[model samples]
Target: MNSEVILTCAVTGAGDTVGKNPNVPVTPKQIADDCIAAAKAGASVAHIHVRDPATGGVSHDPAHFREVMDRVRDSGVDIVMNITAGGGGDWIPDPADPTRGGPGTDIQTPAERHHPVGELLPELCTLDCGSLNFGDMVYVNPADWLREHARLVQAAGVKPELECFDLGHVWFARQLQQEGLIDADPLYQLCLGIPWGAEADTETMLAMRNKLPASAQWAAFGIGRQQMPMVAQSVLLGGHARVGLEDNLYLRKGVLASNAQLVEHAASLIENLGARVMTPARTRDHLELRGAQTGGEA
Candidate 1:
């Protein structure tokens, strides 16, 4: 019943979703426009991930991110930009060697993964808490690497959103907080329903929420069909909600959706739950986020 639930729209993920959904935005212009639409529809935050235009594959290119940032700023969307610093950690290890990596691995240094955040210095950025068996491949992020990344991101004056895929990851995030690697008013994104990660259900969400530090601020999102359900759950449980093409592509069964449509749906649900969606400016103030930079004057 609290009117404090902030809505975040993850425009397009770095997943293999472009081919699956025609509505998925590929170009920077399209992505920015989608983000603007989402903001218009009541999304307080816009989480971004750039892709390779040629293959529609995930990319860590800072130039692509720059293009997206420029376009979003130029559009004057009034949405908090939260860039992903979680890419470039994928590793498909060689079965034969076991030590060396195999092809299809987009392995890069932690610094490489954070290049966009370091350069652009968005109001918010993601810091994936732990490594996991992401499907068949291993998403590698050791503790040392994460500590270094936390230090670098904090130093850059960007608010780090701790993304935890499981309970153990949350534990690691707490360790980071205890070590003062992250700020006191830390933000967390509870990612559920991923392959081999936390399950998407009320019990799992409640358990994770209960474990969070008292000083921590957080949001919860579920993938696919559980996405909308978690929106209501998150709001009812005193947390924010996120939804969009990144987490889901369908507005309903067999119905394709644009990012704005997802935001609209989320807003309706929040309103139904007796909660009102906050604007980006309000969200920035609520989370104590640094103000965004004006690149192209949007």
Candidate 2:
């Protein structure tokens, strides 16, 4: 088991959850505040995604990201910023015409998706290792695209949190490392419980975690009701943990939760499991992240 766990809270994911949960932060200011709240509640990192403030829909706007980053930095909080590069992959194919993109299709070049991360230059950012049938939509992160994305992220001097949704993704991650695309020490995020991808059960988490490079530092999270359970499972398996409104909304059955509540709950679970939660300083040291804020390798 991991003696010290780095807790990350993915605040305000690009999902249709604002209408369902009033506590979901929509605007840039709200999102930044949520990050601060997560930090105060014992989160070492904040995995962020911007939204169209007016519609609460997923937005790839660099302006929104800048505002959120500025607000968080200006707040005097010391949480590690982990921006999202997982946007522009939603592919809801047209029902009638298979060749045409449907109304919900939002695909973009690797450069377009990496624009915000390259511009903002956060310490850590998510680089989805591979594509999978995410629910009804095919979240396309093709191998070539992934290679290009990895190169771009490396050029920008950012550490990627390899989001592995399946065992194949873990395999592909190792290939990227073997090809010298990824940095010396890789970081993995075992994304679990998403539809048509890796399941939330213990067996799947173990299978994916076992596939990581021995030198890799990793964390795992499960969506919806399995969020807390995965926190325990991840720590027990010697990996870090993530929790927030991005993955799960409820604190308990029929009870809505804020991002801070989720972090606090996860922190409690980690402590109860005889593992101490790592602070922002310790997490940066552990991950060897780079950025102006961390003062390592800018």
Candidate 3:
């Protein structure tokens, strides 16, 4: 088992959770605060996704991203910034015209999707390995699109967190590595429990983790109730852990959770298991991260 672990907190994802949980951050300041709080609570990295402040919905505006980045950087937090480059891939079929995209269909070219990551240049950014049936919609990241996106991320000198939602995604991610698109020691995040994606279980996590490159740095997270269980399982399986409001809304049954609480709980779990939490500096070194300031190392 891995004795030292890096815990990442995905502060606010671009999901329909604002109404469900009032504490879910929407504005740039709130998102930045949550990132700082999670770092103070022992999260080595913060995975970020900005929402439209007026509507509190998913957004791809570089201005919004810049505001959030500025706040986080100015806050003097030592945590690594991991911006979400996996946006703009949602596709919903039109009820009237089934052949084309629908009202909720938000797709973009590789350059458009990579705009924020390229402009702000976060230390780490996520690249969803492949597409999957996400509830009624489909998250459409095709092979060619992924190839171009990976190349773009590589040229930006940022580490792409290969987000694998299923077994096929793992296979595809390995293909990207073999083609040398992933420059640094590839970082992987086995995303579980999304609709129609990989199931949240020990066997599934192990299968996905085992398929990773031997030199790759990997972590796994489960959505909803399986979040904490997967953290323990990941660590026991010699991988890192991820937690925060992005993946789970509740700290326990019927309890809404903040990003910091989730990070605190994950840190406690790592310590209780006879392992120490890796700091942001250590994570940067381990993952070979490129950007972000070291204002106040946690």
- Assess each prediction's global lDDT (C-alpha) against the native: 0.89, 0.93, 0.91
- Best-performing candidate as measured by TM-score: 2
Candidate 2 lDDT tens digits, 1-298: 9989999999999888999999999999999999999999999999999899889999999999999999999999989999999999999989999788899899989999999999999999999989999998899999999999999999999999999999999999999999999987899999999999999989999999888999999999999999999999999999999999999999999999999999999999899889899889878877876633354321
Query: On lDDT, who's better, 1 or 3?
Result: 3
Candidate 1 stretches with Cα past 4 Å from truth are 95-99, 292-298
Query: Candidate 3 local accuracy as lDDT?
Result: 0.91
Structure candidate 2, residue pairs in collision = none
Per-residue lDDT of model 1, residues 1-298, tens digit only:
3567879999989888998899898887788888889989989999999888888888888898889889888876688999999998888888888788888788778889889999999999999999998878888889999999999998999999999999999999999999989985889999999998899899999999889999888899999999999999988888999999999999999999889899999999999888888878778778877863333221
lDDT computed for candidate 1: 0.89
Model 1 TM-score on a 0 to 1 scale:
0.95
Model 3 off-target regions past 4 Å?
Answer: 291-298
RMSD in Å for all candidates:
3.2, 2.3, 2.1
TM-score of each: 0.95, 0.97, 0.96
User: Of the candidates numbered 1 and 3, which has the greater TM-score value?
Assistant: 3
